[model samples]
Target: MRRLGSALLAVSMFAGCGGLETEPSPESLTSPSFESQQAPITTTDVDVAPECKGIITFVNTATFQTLDAYLPSNVVTNLVNRRATAPFTSLADVSSVSLVGETRLKQLEQGARARGAINSTCVGIFDGLALSTSDAAAIVSLVNTIDDSELHDVLPDAWNGAANLLNLRPFTSAQAISNVAGIGEVSFRNIRNAATLSRPFEALAAAVNAIPSNGSAGVQLKRHFDWWNEVTAQHGYSQGGPTCFGLEPSSVPYGATIRPYLANSAEVMAEVQSTLDYVDADTKISPNVIAAGMANLSARTQGRSFKGCIFSYADDPWSRHNVAIFVDTVNGFSVFSETWWAE
Candidate 1:
């Protein structure tokens, strides 16, 4: 088995030969070229007891008759701005509104659970990723035990390998919610059925929609791989990414790219794989033509496909973040994506 380091060394040498005319830093790369529309992210933390009295119920939290005094004024205003006439079905829907992220949603959940009469409001949804047994069990128990909240047969099917995903925390991103190791098409259908059963939880459907099914290409593939050839992806997606690698792009290919490392090892691998892909795609280019990319050894080694990497990090949500797109032979994804913390 060739170590990951050997692959990195192979790719690094390719990058050194005039890959970039300019290097990107956090500052330079702040405005992302390929991200979705921009929204302000403000984190507001609210503490609530498990049981308490609150005015707005989470199941239909959009119509908070009286905003909690505890909620920051800006948050209340933000909610009001997003809500039109219909009451909010769940916190997840509220999150769809601009500027509402995980922090504000949690604050609302905590307060609503304490004060509102509706107890079945779902706080989080899981896609089909791994989960620890206990966490999986907790969700399973919630589904089975709830009256209209019945997850019933759905949870068990999704729980096939709950033990593997426990520490992974796959629920964090839209792309992360997949049936990779835990849930499957059956479980997904089960959940969808439960939602249609006129369950008490209005949020279940939205959470269900978050998962990808029907043999859809994985969601994160676009972020890292679309621009796998940073040389082309650097131009921006709307501008048209490279359709072909030209068998072998030049040794000192003009417009070929050498990007600064994005943030962590997980991100670097995406770029590495992109580089390797270009080399492998063209008969003229040899693996020996690759180079060390990004900042350091850890950054370059992150893309080693020998590790059996299968996915890339969920594209960073914050618009200020940077992305590196390059090509490689095998797909490179990160195991630590579950543990990645935004600085």
Candidate 2:
């Protein structure tokens, strides 16, 4: 079993005895443009004491609207009121606010760190990466589930220690990898780096795995759409309003620069139409309504360019009814469409 390269087309059917399916022709589905579209990632070194001056500053100085994006409104209100009378002096002081638990504290810390507010060191090898909780979780999942061969492929330099990782199955945390024999700091760093680079494919696989093998097309499509929203939201992508006629906006970060690649709107819509035709073979939804919905989606995003791919699951008989559209806009937001029909 070779690694599914950048344009991973490996399909996993949800039916009995799942096996890899053949790649669809390029004309049908656009592969992810990870290799070309990925930008250079820069990280800062944080070698300091336990004091989290950055987190304290962010909580005290950031505006309420900015704070609201990273925290619950109630927690934000409590933090604001608490900080107003007396600014938080330490992480403990921030935690003392009502509704601020360990998890919430981590969220705040990560959010602050992402905004360059945290200059001090934190726990975990992934701390400096400023990863969202979801991205960290995704990396953790990749490490726990990836086999030795795949691990070696991703971290060729760490191949000698790959066996140690496989033997120590089900790593409870990303940090737990450090405990493995032969997995030194460099190996751990490489593994985490690889995991981060592979997040897009991991996200796609996770979304596909979420769909039920035996369900109405409507149900499965909705499942994939929901999973996409949840995962993207965890990565700081904002969601727009609910789906309008099986078409909804994809989650994308505010003020993000949209880089159009892989395919244009016309190509994406064609692939989408092809997927809908496959679904219509067995679904009760009329072709006319599907066309109208697609037209609406087109009209909504007209003249706007996108850079992403459409994953069509029409190869596997059981999963053929599902399709995933992941496209990005100039605003650094991803737009998604959820095509559905009543069963």
Top-scoring candidate (lDDT)? 2
Give the local distance difference test score of model 1: 0.31
- Single out the weakest 10-residue window by summed lDDT for candidate 1: 5-14
> Taking the tens digit of each residue's C-alpha lDDT, what string does model 1 give over 1-343?
0111111101011121121222222232122331121111101111111111121223233333334444667766666655434444333445666655655655654554444331332233333111222233433433333321012212443444333334354353322434446655345334333322222112221222243433412112121111222332233332222222212332222333322222344544454444334323223322232221122324323444222122223334421212332222222221211111233
Quote model 2's TM-score.
0.30
Q: What is the lDDT of residue 165 in candidate 2?
A: 78
Per-prediction TM-score, please?
A: 0.24, 0.30
User: Any idea what lDDT model 2 has?
Assistant: 0.44
The number of the candidate with the highest TM-score is 2
Please give the clash total of every predicted structure, in order: 39, 5
